[model samples]
Target: MSVDAERPAPLMHAWRHPAPKGAAGRCIGARTDLPVDRRKAKRLAHRIRAIARREGLPRAVATSPLARCRDVGRWLRRFGFRHVVDAQLAELDFGRWDGRCWEAIDAAEIAAWSADLVGHAPGGGESVRVLLSRVRAVHARAPAALLVTHGGWLSAAVWLALGEAHAPTAATWPKAPGYGRRVILWRLQAPALHRPSDR
Candidate 1:
C-alpha cells in the first residue's frame, strides 16, 4: 500500500489534459467563471479515470482547489478515485489578473511577465520558481499521486524534475502540458524515469 513498500513502487505519470485552451483568455478565470465545456470536461475525466483503473489506482490526487479542478476530481471520485487531495494542488495565482482574459492583459505587462516568470508576479501571479519549489516540496513526500494544476505549474514541475536550471514558458520536452492532451508520465527516479511496477 505504501510507495516504499509496494513490490515495485507505483511510477509517477504527469498527465497533461489541455484544460479548454481555446479560452486562451479564459483559462485563468474564477471557479464560477469556469467555462461550460461539459462535453470536453467529461471526456477528459473519462480518459484520466481510465488511466487510473489501468494503472491499478483507485483515485488520483490533485494540487489545487479550483472549481474546475474540483469538478474533475469529483468526476474521478465517482469513477473510483479513493481520494483527491485538493489543498496542495492550486495553480499559481495571477493576482490582479485572476479573472481577466489574455486579450485584456497589457502587452508590456505580458512581456514583463513572460520575460521573467521567476522573480516577480508581473501579472500578479506566482512565479515559475515559486510554483516549482512549492510543488516539489509537497510532491517529494507524496506517493504516485496525480496533479491537476495549471499548465504553468506542470511545465515547471517537469522542468525541475528533469534537472534543468530553469523552466521555459513552453515545454520543449514534448509532454502533455495542457487541458486535453495525453502527456507522458515520468517517475522521479534519480534520472526521473524509474521502472514501473510489475503488477
Candidate 2:
C-alpha cells in the first residue's frame, strides 16, 4: 500500500539468513534448501526482536520458503509475530549451478555473467532484472515490513532502494552484510514508485 505524504513513513527491516550449515563457499541458491545454524539463528532472532521493540514492532514479518530463511521466520514466532512465506523473497535460482562449489563452476560462464550482470541468466536461471522486479513488487505491497531472506535478494533490494541508476563498480558495490545481520532502509519521501497490483 502507498504511504500517505502527511503520515509518518513506515519502518523496514531486512535481514539475511545466517550461514547455511553445509553450503559455505558454494552457490546454494533457490534450488538448495540447506539447514541453518541454530545457535546463530536464535542469537540473530533475539537481536532482531530487540531492534523491533526499539523501533516499534514490525507490522508484518516475511521470509523466503527456503529452510534457511524459514528457520529464522520460525524464531520470529517466539515473540508472537506471524510470518508469510513469499516466493519473491527466494534467492536467484542458480539452475544447473545450484549447490556447486563456486571454484568448480566454469570460469568462462562466470566471466560472461560478470560482464552482463543485469541481463545474464547464468546456468539458465533468472537474471538480475527479474530479481529486482520481483523485489520491487513485494515492496509495493508492503512498503515497510520485516524480511528474512537470502543474500542475493537483500543485495537486489538495497540496489533498488538506492535507485537503479547505474551498475556499481567494484568499489561502489556493497559488501553483503554478515550472516544474521540486519539492515534497515527508510523509504524516501517521493511518491510510491510502484503500484501494489501492477505486477
Candidate 3:
C-alpha cells in the first residue's frame, strides 16, 4: 500500500454559519459581508460549546472573517473559547457577481463556470481548484480543529476528503451542508513525504 493510503486520516468538525440577512436570492460570497441575526449566532455558539464539552474537543474555534460566520465565533469568545478569524475559511470569492442578485448575472457566465468547475474563476474570482487548495491548507494546519465557515468552504473540504481525483461536474459536486448544521470530516490524504536529508 502507498504511504498515503496507509496513513490515518485527520479529523475536523465544521459547521455552516447561520443564514445571513438579505442573502436570499443573492449570490453571497467572500465579497458579500452580510450580518446574521445575533440570536441565531448565539444559538449556534451554544450548540458548538455543548458539542465540544461532550466530545472533549479543544476550546478553540475558527471561523471565516465574514460577519455571518464571525458572529458565531464572537459568541464563543464570550463563553471563554479562543476564537480565530481566518480569511482562508471565507466562502468562494465571486468578484463582481458577489452581493448581486442571482438573476442579475449573465447566464453564459454561469454556464462557463459550470463547464470548467475546477479551473474557471466564477465572476472572475476564485476557482474551485483554488478553494480546494485553501481548504487543504487549513486541514494541514489544524486537522482536528473546530470550524465555523461557509457552505462553499465546507463543500471544498468534503471534496478533498473524498480523494479529489478528478474535477467534479455540476452533477457530481457535493451539496453544501445545511445552515447552522455541523459535519465531521476526516482527511484521507497523508501529509507529504519528506526526504530523510530534508527532515
Highest lDDT scorer: 3
Q: Per-residue alpha-carbon lDDT of model 2 for 1-199, expressed as tens digits?
A: 5445865555457788888888878998999899888887777677777777876767468999999888877888876778799999999988898999999999999988888887888788988779878877777887668888888887776666566467644345445676776666555223333221110
**What value of lDDT does candidate 3 attain over all alpha carbons?**
0.84
What are the per-residue Cα lDDT tens digits for candidate 3 across 83-195?
99999999999999999999999999999998989999999999998998888888878867989999999877776666655678887777888899876775534222211
Q: Which stretches of candidate 1 lie over 4 Å from their true place?
A: 1-11, 26-33, 166-176, 184-199
Please report, as a residue range, the 10-residue window in candidate 3 with the lowest summed lDDT.
Answer: 190-199
lDDT by residue (tens digit), candidate 1, 1-199: 2234534554455444335534554436333235426666567678777777776754755635665566666667777665455554666677777767767878888788756657667466566667667757756776676655555556556565566543455324324254654433344423443322212
Ranking by lDDT: 3, 2, 1
Higher-scoring candidate on TM-score, 1 or 3: 3
Worst 10 residues of 2 by lDDT: 190-199
Deviating ranges (above 4 Å) for candidate 2 = 1-11, 167-172, 188-199
Candidate 2 C-alpha RMSD relative to the actual structure:
6.1
Best by TM-score: 3
**1 against 2, candidate with superior TM-score:** 2
Query: What do the candidate models score in CA lDDT, each in turn?
Result: 0.56, 0.75, 0.84
